[model samples]
Target: MEGHPPGLETVTLPPYSPELQPVERAWNLTDEPLANRCFESLAEL
Candidate 1:
């Protein structure tokens, strides 16, 4: 809460709890290319 205004509380989730994080669900789409193949260069990528 360093950047947030006072009185705003933060809750910490246990490690490895992917179900609690929505972004975890989208990782498959972003990771698919990196997992299936390798790119030789930035242009080819």
Candidate 2:
């Protein structure tokens, strides 16, 4: 996977366009590892 990790797990956002808004790229970068993750309280998080 070190060769290219994005091909497997990348959650591709909208079609990347240089002409788009200031948001360079928008994707849930923390979706997998953070999935089903919770804290008993806000302080715990």
Task: Per model, state how many residue pairs clash.
Answer: 0, 0
Q: What lDDT does model 1 reach? A: 0.90
Give residue 7's error in model 2 in angstroms.
43
- Inter-residue clash pairs, candidate 2: none
Give the per-residue lDDT digits (tens) of candidate 2, residues 1-45: 366656575445568654464453434564666679987988876
- Candidate 1 lDDT by residue in tens digits, 1-45: 598789898899998899999999999988987887888999998
Tell me the spans in candidate 2 whose CA falls farther than 4 Å from its real position.
1-33
Q: How far is candidate 1 from the true structure (C-alpha RMSD, Å)?
A: 2.8
Quote each prediction's TM-score. Answer: 0.58, 0.27
Tally clashing residue pairs in candidate 2: 0
C-alpha displacement of 27 in model 2, angstroms?
5.0
Cα misplacement distance, residue 12 of candidate 1 (Å): 0.9
Quantify all predictions' global Cα lDDT against the true fold. 0.90, 0.60
